[model samples]
Target: MRFDIPLPDDTARLEALAHLDGLVKPVGSLGRVEELAAWLAAAHGSMPPRPLDDVRVVVFAGDHGVSDPAGPHGAVSAYPREVTASMVRVFLAGTSGVTVLARQVGARVRVLDIAVDGELADVPAEVTAHKIRRGSGSIDVTDALAPGEAERALAAGMAVADAEIDAGADLLIPGDMGIGNSTVAATLVAAVLGLPAEDVVGTGTGVNEAGRARKVAAVRAALARTADRASDPLSTFTALGSACAAATAGFVLRAAERRTPVLLDGVFSCAAALVCAELAPEAPRWWLAGHRSTEPSQAFALKALGLTPLLDLGLRLGEGSGAVQAVPLLRSAQAVISEMGLLADLA
Candidate 1:
């Protein structure tokens, strides 16, 4: 679905500001929440804005070519491609905790396949296939994805966001699932935030001490291999990131253009956010950092982006689970702005 996000009308914004001024509260008493509500009202071309009731979480799943490298942090031994397809299946079956929490909060979860290899058997009806390539190119020795493939993955993400908005979704959560994605994510963070690979690489999906060391080494090697390329941010993604990272970056840009808020997941999601911020600096205003991960690199990325995480429960899971869990808190923030009576009125 093609969508053209309209800018806020001047008349509508003026009316919203007037309504906010006349509300039963001290001027600027509710602080940033009130400003956010007013901004939403203006974005919708309305006064006294209504709550954004519909929320959809779009999880993009793919595979990383870096998984085949001769490193200790390579793909887990128990499962290979099956793990990617299997976890997606679990999500579609509503058996995963993320699905449970989303259902509890009345949010719809949509899974998108961007670059997984092979066809999924008995695919659930909710999963949408938007594959750009069978899988990304190997980043251990070559570019992660072709430049054209990077654009295609980005367009695929924007397409999903457009479709969800047409179906009445006013807020979006872009999640990711791909084994060995932390390698790509770490590379992206290092390139954008100007940090060394050691500061941005971390143990993803519960890697142990030895595995963590291996992961860090793999990232450093990749960074060293790509040090001389003077490419732009998009080139950085195509060179060293996965489809999930590229798509998530596009989703954030599209969401910001539409003035819709986005809930971000962990390191991968934050990597995407950093890319989106590079593409459009104002995009950060529409983002809410969901949680801080147990991964040290995630903390560094968050700090570099100047974000204060809403929760820090030692979460290291990166399948949008942490972000989904924080949805209620976002709603509560909105509620405080929309429903609370002002102290001045009470007095």
Candidate 2:
């Protein structure tokens, strides 16, 4: 299915190149800033790429079936599944890293309760509820989600993108928060790349050696169930992606369709981006990787997408913190390309 994602506008992008070349820097001295400026110009489809006037961070919250501490992988979580619900409250209270960085950047924070395993009592009126299922089925035993549930999550994500655009958001960042999420991400990556889980899986949420071993085992067993379907992105997602990742994939595609630029976050974000790329080949054109995470699977995903991140501070924190931290650099790049004095004029 060819999704409706728009191709980057080459004409405007060429114009942006000319505009950046006209700046006082000795042609590309600004490095990735120039690269980002060109991409913004294409994505915005306008000259000067307009300052990043408004940015929106959407945190997709869910819980993993592997997170049942009483369940088989329960031995794998640094925290319980209930923490997913509690963290939603923390995000709502604006005390998390994403909230603080977004507030500093003058951006808005919107949390979506797509499939949290527990209740978020008295959630703010704005929190979008697009829960496709209470929690995913265990991929090691069965498909994480039914195909119909995956489709519903995708449509809900598209709707969220439309709502943000209507509300005047020019830049969108999708974040993921879920317990035992790394297992899901690792499963998707391993299956898609036909890689052994040991190469792709890592210590998530600060798991110990034994926990990492359990995660690897779970991912390997899941891929055995995934066998043929593993190579197809959407099928892999249906087979093992967390609800949050699947929704983020849809949101990424929809944002690209709207021509909004996105700075993608770490491992889980890259996993979603892989699905986005698979669903629509042109989707990655409208986004940039904000950082390369410590997770080996994230690197594998980034390699597949052909995106190079702007920073590498050894960051592994999710919730869009790494992506948001790169926003100022985006602003600086825009300013340098749009406001710096021309070299000819200086001469």
Which numbered prediction scores highest in lDDT against the true structure?
Answer: 2
In angstroms, the error of model 2 at 69 is: 3.0
The superposed Cα distance between candidate 2 and the true structure at residue 270, in angstroms, equals 0.9
lDDT of each: 0.73, 0.83
What would the per-residue lDDT of candidate 1 be over residues 1-347, giving only the tens digit for each residue?
23344455567657655656656777776565555566556655655555668978888888877775454346522236557777888888887767887888888888777877656767854464677766776676678888687787778787787788878887788888887777778878887777886677666776666666666777777777788988666787788887778888888778877777777888888987887677676677667788888766677777777787878888876778888887776666456545665445755
Clashing pairs in 2: none
State the lDDT at 200 in candidate 1. 72
Ten-residue segment with the worst summed lDDT in candidate 1? 70-79
Q: State, as a TM-score between 0 and 1, how close model 2 is to the true structure.
A: 0.96
Candidate 2 segments exceeding 4 Å error: 228-231
Q: Superposing all C-alpha atoms, what RMSD in Å does each candidate have to the true structure? A: 3.7, 1.6
- Of candidate 2, the 10-residue stretch with the lowest lDDT total is 67-76
